[model samples]
Target: MKTDLKLNVLSVGNTSTGSRSLPSQFAEPIRPDLVKRAVEAIQGNTRQQHGSKKEAGQRHSAKLSRRRRDYKTSYGHGISRVPRKILTKRGTHFSWVGAVAPGCVGGRRAHPPKPIKIWAKKINDTERRKAIRSALAATLVKTLVAQRGHHVPPQYPFLLENKFEAIAKTRDVIEALEKLGFNDELNRSSEKILHAGRARRRGRGTRRKKGPLFVVSNTCSLIHAVQNIPGVDVVPVHQLNVSLLAPGAHIGRLTLFTEGAIERLEKEKLFMQEYKNLHPPVPPAPQSPASHSKLQNPSNTQKQSQPTQQKTQQPSALQPQKKVSPTKAPSTKSKPASQMTLTQLTK
Candidate 1:
């Protein structure tokens, strides 16, 4: 079945036993947008919420008096508006030290994180599934896997046989991985880094490099074998998620699939939407008669006919409107010289 497929099933001894065709999910187009969204949503959903204690900084009774003789009051005292409690008193005077206010020695924070605040993000089901498919396709691309900093072998993106899943010893698993050309990859991930100076102070001291992923059909001995390996992960096919597929929201992680896992993926159709649950087609609305449709609403029919009726009722251009005759004004100074009489002109 490997006719056009470039994938091969590798035995525990690192020999190609047969070829296997990739599922349609592997042919999905790579979409970084969807992948990033899904990964971020997962990260946000996994975030733990924390906040300051309820009684923090409010444990002390720092109330002060406003009387003239009271030293606790800031009435005559040349002190700031900060609330202070009398720690030590002597006769008529008292020691009023600042506390219970912001900027004081031990005061409540202006704003603190609230444990009730939601930190999770949500994405559509179809979008999340598409993102997973995209990530799966990204795994097969040699350029992407290499770009993700994995030590890719000559036969990159090959699947392991079901027999490989039976090995329970970590040493045997390492030997098999080394034979499959992952020795350098394993060595690279094994080395740890101790952050220096400020980075260490920020709790980032020890770090391990991310390594290749192993995907299998179910919980098997392989899962426990790789548990001791740094950055090496083995997840069952059904439990696959965006975070596992593309760690840190970056596309493409070196992934090894077991032959049984791929077959299970095809059988279960993981992450793909099911068609049986879709809504049944609604029966087509019965066609109504043209006359009845036009008369469905009297208001609409009136509104449409009003304009056409006005156009038809308008008089034709052949009959022109009569012009209003202008009335003559009293003669006096308004009359022109030619129209005025000879005696009137002399006057």
Candidate 2:
């Protein structure tokens, strides 16, 4: 079945100039599992490697002896066997405290984060490509978009005319967005709030709602114009990824595509292979004996019919049939793997 999915291309004035068919990527199956994995993999790759210093909290020269009657001996001291630091001594009695243990003060952590530890999660190339296609498909889904807390326009899957890329001023970009019925969304994203808890002190002082993403064919003046707007991001179609489209492993983001970007997607055939598999070609039906006889000559008909009979009989003889054991019955319970959803599997 062919999908006649199309998006209306709006001009700068929010007037519908024309409609164009959506690319095959938009028709890809919504595999939330792949999308989440791709997003996580991208995030993991960007994480900075961090670890505690090797000699941190372990430079103390203090030592304790376990041998009895030995100087600074911790054994038979009426205290637990542990490394101790001596403070003051009088005769055979000495004042000391435990050290170098995780439970003790100024001690090394039991399992500190190591810089050598791998943080990046590997994803198959095909899976990553499928994920990008899934994320792109989610953008066209109204339910998914709304679930992501985006204020969408009445006409979903918004597409813009090529002229939008010519916008050079931030004011013009805001005005164009307002005229396109995005005033509510613009206002929503503009309301920034102070981050809760320690996040504010950790450099993420303010947080704002994610607004519509502008996807263009190439670098243009509009990129500068829209970037200044709160929560608005301008990304070229070639650089599109699951993380950008489905932030925080959540599927669906309000996206605006330029006419040129849509054309480029079709021309490049990105994610076309995955899309083709979603709709496989149906196999031809088997021909009946009457129809088969009509297609063949009278003399050859007997020969063809004999082979067809033999072919059907051969499968029964060649194929091994399993003996049903009366003692055992097939399990009705579904396998955990088969029962798991994409989100659960990804997690």
Candidate 3:
């Protein structure tokens, strides 16, 4: 648990509202193996099942006999004892030709498919949840997001305010993202990729890039606003899975979360089944019980030790000169006390 890990919260206008500590959901270790497994399972479950017709070619008569005294027998004939249809017959004599069998006309299939076959794959609930956490953690890393071909600003890993969920117009959303320096990312995700294969014949060969994902606490108008944007997806925070978090089993999907969504994830323990006990929620602060790791303080209340610098300037009388120091600027780093203003028991 990175109790000191704080991220700046940016509004839709690209201005920082305040800093917030990341939830325990992002504290998980990156386990690519589990992520890949979960993605494969999801892919398997989504596969459309199909097979050949049940009774493709079984509508012909091809019965034959090897008896010498029978009416339609192949006895005393030079042909082998194979199933066939009788073309013409005489008393104790028969003329026949092969039919109604594999390699013959109108014969049943050698091996046909059945609809009963299952195409879905199984994954344990525990492993699935762990994979989700791992993927979630990967999203906060700047290098991974950049390596995945996403255009990230300097403040790549920032949280979103609840105000972002209220935008209901695509034009306004694009305008807000532009203000945040995401024009390049939007263009990158808007391009169409054409693949050359039989899938093209089905009119589905063209695909768009997978871009930013918006996770909200509740269903809002933002879902409808970003629906038509190429490669962008809006999903409820509770519905997060390996597929959305890490598309095609690849890590580092650029994600945006509303402040309410972050609180909900922590308060409800959304994707932390295995590690839920590891970082048990501390006693809720008297001001707010809706907050989880964000609103709590460290157990040890000892003050942080500050480093002091000793002056080594030689103010000797030889030159009778005193060196002047430039004015120092205040530190921009946010402290735990400053972060308390973000979700202070009120929106």
Candidate 4:
């Protein structure tokens, strides 16, 4: 069965060229549970393992014995039976301070983090793939995109022509986005706020809102051009994951897709290979009688299409062809075949 969803294909000028059917993955149900699990797994893998050293805060020479008459004993002392370090003392009488305990100063932590602790959360391969599809589907929902706090164009799931990948200039990319009705979104993402509390002190000093994500079929100059733009990200279709699509376990992100990316997604059967095997893509509809006639009468159609076909039929005169010339062999001595050029060997 054909999907009811049809995304408008936008030209380089931000004009709608036509429409294309979305991939089956975009039709998957939004499963927030799977999305959150997948995102947590991804984030978990990136967590840096950290822990206090084994000797940290426990290197002091402090020692105390509760046994009566033992050396450095605290017996008969008013203080509790805790380890104590000597400060200053008189003969047979000592002034001690608690040490090597959680309540004491410069003491080891009660429950310090351990390096051996496993930080990564495990997820099934199928569940991770499903989460990616769910997140991808969420991007197409206007309400979900809005709920995620993204300022989006009126048309959700923005689709751009394949030509959009060739964009090499940041200014041109910005202009195209503005024309596509994302001026407000661009402005919104541009605003940066200082991170609150310790996070600011630690490396993440500022944070910016995530803007529209551009998903293309392959790497291109556009990736470099958009890197400097605040909050804007360019990712290849194959590299798409749940974390990028649904940051903080929240579904829905403003996403822009190139026509080539859509084609790749379907052809590769990404994230929905199992479902695609059950239902193959529908074949193109039969051409109309009038359209069939136009196809049959190629002579008439060729005359009308001559101008567009000329570039392919003839090579450009501006590009000069290179010429190869025969070379004369040296009379002194014959060189090895490997050392001689083809032209020199011919002589």
Cα lDDT tens digits, model 1, 96-203, are 777878788888887878989899999998999999989999999999989888899999889999987898999999999999999999998999999888988888
Query: Comparing candidate 3 with candidate 4, which one achieves the higher lDDT?
Result: 4
Q: In order, what lDDT does every prediction score?
A: 0.86, 0.85, 0.84, 0.87
Total clashing pairs for each candidate: 0, 0, 0, 0
**Cα RMSD (Å) per model?**
11.7, 23.2, 33.9, 24.8
lDDT (10s digit) by residue, model 4, range 170-243: 99999999888889899999998997889977999898889989999989999999999999999999888987
Q: How does residue 79 of candidate 1 score in lDDT?
A: 75
- Measured with C-alpha atoms, the lDDT of residue 262 in candidate 1 is 89
> Of models 1 and 4, which has the larger lDDT?
4
lDDT of 2 by residue, 188-299 (tens): 9999789779898899989888899999999999998987899899998877888888888898899999999988888777655533343479999999988888787576
Ten-residue region with minimum lDDT total, candidate 4: 304-313
Enumerate residue pairs that collide in model 2. Answer: none
Evaluate model 4: give its lDDT.
0.87
Of 2 and 3, the candidate ranking higher by TM-score: 2
- For candidate 3, lDDT tens digit of each residue in 140-258? 99999999999998888888999989999999989988888788999999999898979899989889889899999989999999988998899989888999999999999999888
Task: Specify the highest-TM-score model's number.
Answer: 4
Candidate with top lDDT is 4
Candidate 3 local lDDT, residue 180? 80
Quality of model 3 by C-alpha lDDT: 0.84
Q: Which stretches of candidate 3 lie over 4 Å from their true place?
A: 57-113, 274-347
Superposed Cα deviation of residue 27, candidate 4 (Å): 1.1
